[model samples]
Target: MDNIISKLRNLDAYPKINEDFYSRTLSGGVITLSSSILMLLLFISELRLYLHAVTETKLVVDTSRGETLRINFDVTFPALPCSLLSLDAMDISGEQHLDVKHDIIKKRLDSHGNAIEARPDGIGAPKIEKPLQRHGGRLEHNETYCGSCFGAESADDDCCNSCEEVREAYRKKGWALSNPDLIDQCKREGFLQRIKDEDGEGCNIYGFLEVNKVAGNFHFAPGKSFQQSNVHVHDLLAFQKDSFNISHKINRLAFGEYFPGVVNPLDSVQWKQETPSATYQYFIKVVPTVYNSVSGYTIQSNQFSVTEHVRTAEVGRLQSLPAVFFFYDLSPIKVTFTEEHVSFLHFLTNVCAIVGGVFTVSGILDSFIYHGQKVIKKKMEIGKFS
Candidate 1:
């Protein structure tokens, strides 16, 4: 056992010091204390960082197919009423959704910006049970009634019972309801009166649009939209006005699910119309993102950059209509975010380096001080240095 102990002691990196050569100074003690404190502080900082999760980002080419993009939006039009405002979405592939209602909610706001009512889209009108007129007159008992489409009907049996139906029929015929006052359905349904009543009220539209992953545009226009001459046009006559206010405030506009540290550039964005008849356009480039949290939760979203432009309406020329248009194109590259924490082994290694490095530096400083003091003492005793 004694032979083994001798061998172990010889192998020790730090040998025991003899008491006769031992010396301690105030400066050395102070430095030792300071280095120890510094090492502890550094170790604590590193440990904290090691314990917390960090997000690492990587970019790759997106090769997804048949994936749909979700657009979540909340927009407020201070001058346009919910009845007059319409939502339309169309893609480069020729798919179109007019007066989009599903998954959409509309809030009626007073001039003060307070919400008065919250309801789904297309909730204003009550459903009619039967057609009111037969051959342009009231139906008699046991008489079959067929509403007229005012020359827009595809067949003689086609019926346009409501003002909206008549308008839709006209849209299909590539014709506008030039004079709603002359239409019996519009007069009875008080469509013109409804527009007048909603004047000065504001609308807050919050909805989600699910669209193809390809490039396309979605717009917020004053009236229902239709295709005429291969061009998208809104029924301006429905509002009983030639111009509209395209001013809007975007409360929230997110491309997909929210993730940690994700910032949507268009949130809380506002624009005031200088002219009543103007077009507000946003050109957007979308980058897909996927986030995987340390807890194994995943979120798929998109980040975007946008450029805005506005064009005033002109009478003679083919002026851009008053609307808020969002044209978005997808990026081929996709970003991935992963949350990770430092391993226990790595944390321990860093701690050891900090402790060993600081101790070695402090010991070297103490050793130099002690040796300089010994040399000076010998010089003074020999009377060779004063």
Candidate 2:
């Protein structure tokens, strides 16, 4: 009992020593608390960075059949190859062959075997007449006849006797007589025939004739197949212009069998088809891999790989992750593709930012308050000892 009382009385005399010890202890405590909070904030920040590295993006492609194929995947993956993709055309079916005749005859012939000539009266001419009309005539006994007519009697009013004079007059005026040589010249010149029959009939005319030799059926075959890669994501989403060529022979006469209502095959057919279809369907398979690293408190995402369909006619577009990140490692690690996978990363990043912000502000305020308190407490201690 005496020893315990002696210890209690000596405790009051040790105030200076106790005061120094308490101040040191409080300072250490504050430092330790601040350090712990900083560590927690760093951990949260790291978690947020991991979430930002992995996101999914959309992929799309246009095909030759005017079809569009869309798929969702990461942006970092490569497209697939063509042979693995399949295509089945629904509209064209069955096998049919078309036959056409190339040999055709083109000749001009008259109604009779013998080529006819113009008559002396400038009528029924096998050759075309120049301005087909008669201009001049002779008067005989007050009756009109051709300029070569003769009178029946030797009368003073004989217009036939004056026929020679009128004929000469008309000839001098550049009028054409019924000359056999002129008619022959016109016939040999290959002019279009304009003939007046001996019965005073009208002109005769003729035109060309055409014949068609069509086959019973038509044929269709598969065209060349190709693959395209490194396609831009924007081009696939909208309509685009594209073309491909197919080498094949088409029969001229049987062209109607395949292309109905086409008048001329050589003129109407495009030897090579232009403007491929703007829509396509694609089947994309994607594998996502992630790699993350932390260097000096900053996290970064690395490269990734992907497999996809790359055929022009069969499939288009590919699959990939929208975003990706690694967690404290540099080696690539495989990850499963999921629709809701981004939620966790988003939540973690946000929480880290919030916690980091709060702790940083609190530390600043606490540091100021601790420094002020220390100054005032030191003054109080000094005054007590004095």
Candidate 3:
């Protein structure tokens, strides 16, 4: 045991010197004090860095497939009435969400932009269990009456019991309900009166749509949309077409789940139509983002960038109707952010480097000052110094 101990001590790199042989000077003391202060400052800086988390970002190719993209939006049309406003979404996957009403809320705003009433997207009351009419002649109260679609029915025995069913039948036939006053279901449900009730009012629509993860567009336009000759069209005369205004303000628009420090470009965006009849379009590029927190939790989200364009309507041309369209496409590259703290071993290594570097530099400077003074004193004594 004694021999082993002696062998280990022989391997020691630092040899101690006696204090009695030490020669300390004022310059040496000053350098020691300055170097100590500098070393302390450096150590404090390193400690702060170790305590705080650092975010590391990297880009990788996105290879995800068959995923669903969720879009959340809160838009306010300051000059469009809720009765005439409609929401539609379509993707490249051949899926369509037209006149979307599920989980949607609409707020009626007066001319002053203040909310007057808030309700779900559907304007009318619930569909009555009993049918409203059957044919040109009124059926007795005890008869099992069946409503009519007024030539829009697909089959002879088809029945349109409610105003919504009547509209659906019209949409299927590629026919716009040009005159709601003539439809018995519409007249019974007071649909035309509802449109006149919200005259000169605005609308605030907020909703979420779950769509296929592909390039697609969702738009806010006036009137109900239908397909005519395989082309998407909206019945511009459903409401007051001549008085349509496309001025709108976007309160919040996000592509996916929320994450910390995420920035969405289109939040709180606003646009006003300068032309009498025009269209507002937003082209958006969505980037998928994955965030890994220091606590081992991960979040899947997305960030987006947008560009706006306006197309004015020609005097007699019908290239497009007044609407706000958001066309989004996904990016092939995905960004990942990782948050982590410095490792214990790494922190210790840096601390040692800082201390050793400062100490070695200070020793060299002290030696230069001491030896320089000694040489000058010897020259002055020999009278060689002028």
Q: What is the lDDT of candidate 1?
A: 0.87
The TM-score between candidate 3 and the true structure equals 0.83
Count clashing residue pairs in model 1.
0
- Report the Cα lDDT for residue 286, model 2: 20
On a 0 to 100 scale, what is the lDDT of residue 256 in model 3?
90
Across residues 1-386, which tens digit of lDDT does each residue of candidate 1 receive? 99999999899998888999767788788889999899999999998999899889999999989999999999999988888889999999999998899999999988888998889986344234444563766756787656678889998789877788888899888787877867777777778887888788899999899999999999998777788999888888756686788789999998999999888889899999987588899999999999999999899899999999988877797767888999999999999999999889999999999999999998998888878888988988889644
Q: How many steric overlaps does candidate 3 have?
A: 0
What's the candidate order when arranged by decreasing lDDT?
Answer: 3, 1, 2
Sort the predicted structures by TM-score, highest score first: 1, 3, 2
Give lDDT tens digits, candidate 2, residues 1-386.
Answer: 99999989898855555554444447557766876787677766666665554433332231123321111111110111110111111112221111111221112123331223311111122222221112232233534332222222234442322322332233333232333223222333322132212111211111111121111111111111111252111111111112212221122211111211113222222122222322211221222222222221211111222221222333465432111111111122323221223466666776667676766776676677788888999999999999
lDDT of 3 by residue, 93-171 (tens): 8888888988899999999999999998873642454444667566566777678887887888998777777887888
Which lDDT values do the candidates have, in the order given? 0.87, 0.28, 0.87
Error of 3 at 54 (Å): 2.8
How close is every model to the real structure, measured as TM-score? Answer: 0.89, 0.17, 0.83
Model 3, residue 348: distance off in Å is: 1.3
Error of 2 at 89 (Å): 20
